[model samples]
Target: MSNTIVANDLRKRYGDVNAVDGVSLTVEAGEFFGILGPNGAGKTTTLEIIEGLRQADAGEISVFGQSPWPRNPALLPRMGVQLQASAFFERLTAREQLRTFGSLYGVPGRKADEMLEVVGLSDKADTQVEKLSGGQAQRLSIACALVHEPELVFLDEPTAALDPQARRNLWDVLRAINTDGRTVVLTTHYMDEAEVLCDRVAIMDHGRILRSGAPAALVRGLEAAARVSVASGVMNADEARTLPGADEVTDDEVSLTISTRDAPKVVAALAERGALEGVQIKGATLEDVFLDLTGREYRA
Candidate 1:
């Protein structure tokens, strides 16, 4: 498959600090790819460089086989961007705003109407943008981005502040877009969303990618060990340590982190002692993998 986006040693600096340092990745055509990281992790900066909104201090980037820098007018109409922050004329209706954006992209007015329908904002087409709720506003932004029927779309936190229902609704819309064969690149802090929506994900921290692969592969790569939690009401740590395969024991629970090869043996040992009553066993999750790699720091 041909890559739709590519970067090699992409670097960017802000005064004395390096915002993006030696990052390299690629997105294949028609792929739904995600960039996952906390705030100030260079996720947005790297995306901006690829989107042609900001210049990189060093390294190289290409989008759809063309350099993203220097503002390629020829490529503008083919790409859609829903930035983290967007503005519009407060008095303009959602339809009006989409129509205006469509005109800028040389799209017909009917195309804007179609996009509004696709985003489920046809009922609110006549409502002023300022009157729309947060979710509605986000949907409008997406509608505007799609008005030109772009081949590639970039969404930065598209469902950041949405309620569960609204987020699910947007996820359906995104799935539909991908089913129609458009490539999508999204950045989000929501790990569940990344796992469900993206075909592959890249985890970044401190301006560099720590790992990148399909979500399931990344989760399975984390030691392939089942976590067995046993709660026996404040058992002595030493007593809990006596259990087979128990590597770590806490005040309230004893965790048996055993590889799949030894899971059956560990379970049989637990069964021999009637320790299955309050036990829980599960495979590693994306969140678990994230914590294991990133060390659970509180972000500002």
Candidate 2:
């Protein structure tokens, strides 16, 4: 598939702060790509530059092989964006909000209603934008972005305000559109969301991308230990630590966890002792890879 977006050595500065530094990435047509990082990371800046909402101080960007800077009208018709902080027409109901946005691209009013159904906002169709709950408003913002059925969609923390069930519902909506061949570019702080939805992900921090690859590939690359847990009273920490393949052990009031390089060996040893009650084993995950690259520290 052809690349829907391409950015190279993209850099942006806000006064003395380097908001985006030497970022480079590509999104293929029909692909679900995610950008992940903590607060103040450059994901949003990088996305804005690519979406033509902002221009980078240095570097090159192309959307559908055309320059995105200077607000290319040609690109605008083919791209849809749902910003982190969404704005709606004053006093507009949910349905009106979508219809207004769809009208911008000559989309029919029926298409607006269809999008409302797709985003699970049909019941809230008559509610004013300001009156919708945070999650409902978020769904409305997403509906506006997809109302025109653009080929490429950009979602900035699309599920940030959603409750768990609403977030999962939106995931289904996004997955459906992507399956229909729409390209989706997402930025999110949720590691599990990125892992489950993205075909590939780029993890960024301090204005630069530290790693980019298929989520599972990145997790495997970490070669981190698997964790096995059971009820705390099943075994003492010292006893758990002595088990074959167990590298470390921790016992809290609720559970006893063993960190091990060999899950099968550790699990077999636990079974031999019949202390396998409530046992759960978890392997390395994308979050582990993320923290390995970006040190644990607070980011504003």
Candidate 3:
């Protein structure tokens, strides 16, 4: 399949510091791709370069077979963007804000009404931007980004600080966007969000990409062979650490994810120690891979 975006050796500097240093990656067409990193990791800068909102000091970028720099006319209308925090008229209602955004692309205002439904904001259509709650405003921002019906969409931390139910609701909306064949590029520090929403992810750090692949593949590439989790049982993390074939073990109170190359052997050892009651087995997760690669857990 052809790639929709290709960035090479992209660099951006702010005075004495490099914000995006020698970063390169490709995004396939119609795929949900995520840029995962902590704060000041160049995720936003790299994304801004691709979206044509910022200039890169060095390297190259191409989106949809055309250079994004120098303000490519053909690229703008085909793309949508939701920045870290969306700014609106504040006075306008959610529905009116979307309508105003649609007019920028020369599309009829009615399209905003359709987008409102897509984002599950139809109930708050008449509420002003300032009156809308955090979650509602976020959903409105996404709706505004997509009101023009672009082929590619950029969503930066779309669900930040949302309640659990609101975040899940927005995830469904995002899935619908991807299902319609719009290529999506998302930047987030949420491990579970990236694992569930992205088809492939690039783990970035300090202005560079550490690894890039499907989430499952990257986690598999870790030294861990299998992860045996004790869901409902409590095992002392220190005791489990010494179990046979256990290379690493993480105990989070009620659950433990034991990384081992030898699953049966590890299980036998655990059983011998009477630690198998209400336990479970599973594969390693993207979060595990992030910790192994960056030596820092994703916190957002």
Candidate 4:
């Protein structure tokens, strides 16, 4: 597949701080690519650079084989952007807002209505923007972005404040967009969201990408054994430390991290000691891989 977005050694700075430092990535056409990181990790900065909203201090960026710089009007019409924060006229209805944006994009009236329906906001079309709930407002924003029938879409934390049901609804909409052959690039802090929605993900930290790959492949690469978590009294860290292939035991939690090869032996040992009580075995998840790579540091 041809790459729709490409960045090489991308660098951006704010005063002395490097907001995006030596970042490089390629997103294929029609791919659901996710950029993930904690707050202040440069995910938004990198996205803005590729969207032609911010100037890069160094390196190169291309979207749809063209530089996303100096305000390329030809490229702008083919791209859709749903920013993390959006504002709408307080008195404008959902339909009105969509119409306004569609007019700006030179989209037909029917196209605006179609996008509103696609985002599941048709019922609320007549409701004022200020009267709509947070989720409804968000859906309206998404509708506006798609009104132009863009080939490439950028969504930053699209589901951040949505309820579970709303988030699920948005996921379905995104899936349909991808099925229609539009490339999507999204930034999110939710690991589960990335695991479920992205065909591929790039994990960013400290202004750089630590890893990029399919979510399942990244988890499988860890090769860690099933994790066993027991109640506090069943076993202690010291006891778990003595088990075969056990590497590290989190203090006082009875959580054991063992090698995949020796997982059976470790289970047998626990069973023999009657310490299997409350023990639960689980496979590795994206969160596990994230913690392993990024540690448990608190990012502001």
What's the best-to-worst order under TM-score? 2, 3, 1, 4
Predicted candidate 3 versus true structure: per-residue lDDT over 131-238, tens digit per residue: 998888888998888988999999999988999998998899999999999999999878999999999999998899999999988887885678788753557788
**Candidate number achieving the greatest TM-score relative to the actual structure:** 2
For model 2 the local lDDT of residue 12 reads: 98
Model 4, span 163-221: residue lDDT tens: 99888888899899889999999998788888998999998888999999999999989
What residue runs in model 1 are displaced by over 4 Å at the alpha carbon? 229-243, 249-262, 266-280
Candidate 3 ranges with C-alpha deviation above 4 Å: 225-259, 268-275, 297-300
Return the top candidate by lDDT: 2
Which consecutive 10 residues in model 3 have the weakest lDDT in total? 291-300
Report how far off residue 200 is in candidate 4 (Å): 1.1
For candidate 2, write residues 175-291 as lDDT tens digits: 987998999999999999999999999999989999999999999999999999999898888889889999999888799999999999999999999999899999999999989
Q: lDDT of all predictions, in order shown?
A: 0.85, 0.92, 0.89, 0.87
Q: Model 3 clash pairs? A: none
Comparison by TM-score, 2 against 3, better one: 2
RMSD (CA, Å), each prediction: 3.1, 1.3, 3.0, 3.1
